[model samples]
Target: MTVALSLGATANLGHAQNTLNVATWGGAYGQSQEAAIFEPFAKETGVSIDTVTYDGRLAKLKTMLNDDGTVVDVIDVSADALNTLCKQGLLETIDASALGAGPDGSAAKEDFLPGALSPCGVASVAWSTAIAFDRKAFPKGAPTAISALLDTAGFPGIRALPNNARYSLELALLADGVPPENVYRELATPEGADRAFAALDKITGAVRLWNKAQQAITWLVEDDVVMAASYSGRLFRAAAGDRNIDILWDGQIYDFDAWAIPKSSDNKKDALRFIRFATVPARLADQAELTAYGPMRKSAFPLVGKHPVINVEMLEFLSTAPQNFQKALKFDAAWWRGNGAALQKRFAAWRARVNAARTDREAARKAKEAAEKEADKAAP
Candidate 1:
């Protein structure tokens, strides 16, 4: 019996005869998918999700591809990586029409966030990096504006930031008083670069850089720093564990992460079925209930529920929420794609210099202490 699926009908996949492997970021985001999609889908369709985790590194996927294709069936990738992979023919072309319709009978193509449904991939979440702080650190008051990141005197403390120059430069410019709309324009020039570097220099000595989102969260948990620029997903996860981390959505840099099928996927049938099952409107909404990442489907927005453990409404924490999202700056991946190499080299040099200066300062302080102790002994 060939069941017909129309534009209005939702897809309900049958039991999977074989296992389907999924690749995703294994953190709060992965746990959300586990609760919302993978576990439920496995029970419903009998397709156990053999999930693997990876940081968003494009080269890893390329290197993993073999004669038959990639070892994984479906992948969760960033929008930027999706574009790069699709252009390189590293991914399989998915029929966008195969996606399930929304609960309100809206077409799959229409229910999804604009530009989210693509020929090669489908967007899962829209996440962002926001200025996060420990509420306990600010005994006087919490910062409500983006400029608080640069005001060392008003909120005196060390800050943690991601090692990426792209976000650092953007936030530096934002804190330096460049208006949101004009940020990219200003950052495109030499003086703007100097201004941004100077803005960062205001707290360069006080900044503790982190390589992972979790590292920044750890610092906050330990009270090693007052604030950090961190991912919404990591913050939400930390908050769920009873950490007092709070985020100011002001000046957040947001972007999308999509799911793509590698060209080498041997189990394309089960993979396609899994994709459809995972992206159903209810599943998308369910995932959002568990994490701070915004579902890429507009239909999922109204269906978003409260956190199962924390019991707070999820919408308020989302990057796409009306109040929080209004002040956000959409991360310009295309712009970065064009200018990243040069800017990255420049940032590397600056970091090298900063590290060297810190080393020299530490050495000088130790030498001064030893000299003072020797002088005290002679006087005695």
Candidate 2:
């Protein structure tokens, strides 16, 4: 059961209101949060919590921060966004002293993963963009490496890739034989950008772009595409029900999702309370059991044992698992913050050209078939 709060009641309400409004990426992720974090905090403190979804757009967040009567109290954002927002002074700097210690009484700062805690944000989960493919689609052989995704001749079928340049560029560079450690360095240069785009050109004919994470898994299950780049957690949930779907941990791009509060939020006290309660080692472990995302707290690992619903061990499926994590790349938040806009413009232009070419080809194919039918009629 998903915990869904009515947006109508939360909107147009000022900080003077009693409820705490949280922005999250809704769907299974939101559901896990509702079960493991929000619901428990609300029950314990009697604080009314309202949840809303966003596309992780910075403009929407900036608008909310600029408004004195904004309803948003806390938001879940990416590390790159958190860094950028913190630097811009749009987010409230969290008081480390107020966060307290972990369940084991260890220092909070020491318990979290390295670089997990920022001036204005704290990480909730470590997630990744991984390759997921349908087992049945590749009967003779399956794609086991990142390069297979770009090798259309070897594995022919529709490929679903994210519309964004962040992960797409990294994967393209990696497929083009760029070393994991050097990916961001290469992406930072004009020549590297050209190389990444050139690599993408090879598979443009077979690629289908998806704007949302869930759509990647849906496209695979529906057979709309044979292979898809998806969030590891989303693919895990879908794979739990459909045995044929499996994730390739190789070359996965790992990153964290952080919780941040707008500087102008009226409910900072309650928001802090919720964040503290939710980040407790036990609570973080509970969330991991509900979803495949790895907890940011190192103490949460020992507590994360099994899937709350499926009874399967959750560690093996996590992106941070020892065996699975070996071949993955850490997403460079600073690099993206510096180069995102320029690369995004390039990516948009390339996608538009590819889409237009595909449209022309489809139109020409239809026109030729019609002309052939008319010729057949005349011959008869």
Give the number of the best model, judged by lDDT. Answer: 2
Q: For candidate 1, write residues 212-306 as lDDT tens digits.
A: 88899888889888898898877777766655778888888889988889877767887888888888878988988987788888778888888
TM-score of structure candidate 1: 0.76
The lDDT values for all models are 0.81, 0.84
Q: What tens digits encode model 2's per-residue C-alpha lDDT throughout 80-164?
A: 8898889998899997666759767889899887777888999988899889898898888988888988998888888899998
Residue range with the least summed lDDT across 10 consecutive positions in model 1 = 1-10
Clashes of 1: 1
Question: What TM-score would each prediction reach against the true structure?
Answer: 0.76, 0.75
| Model 1 ranges off by over 4 Å | 1-19, 25-31, 46-48, 52-56, 68-72, 95-97, 137-140, 179-182, 241-244, 266-270, 310-312, 332-338, 348-380
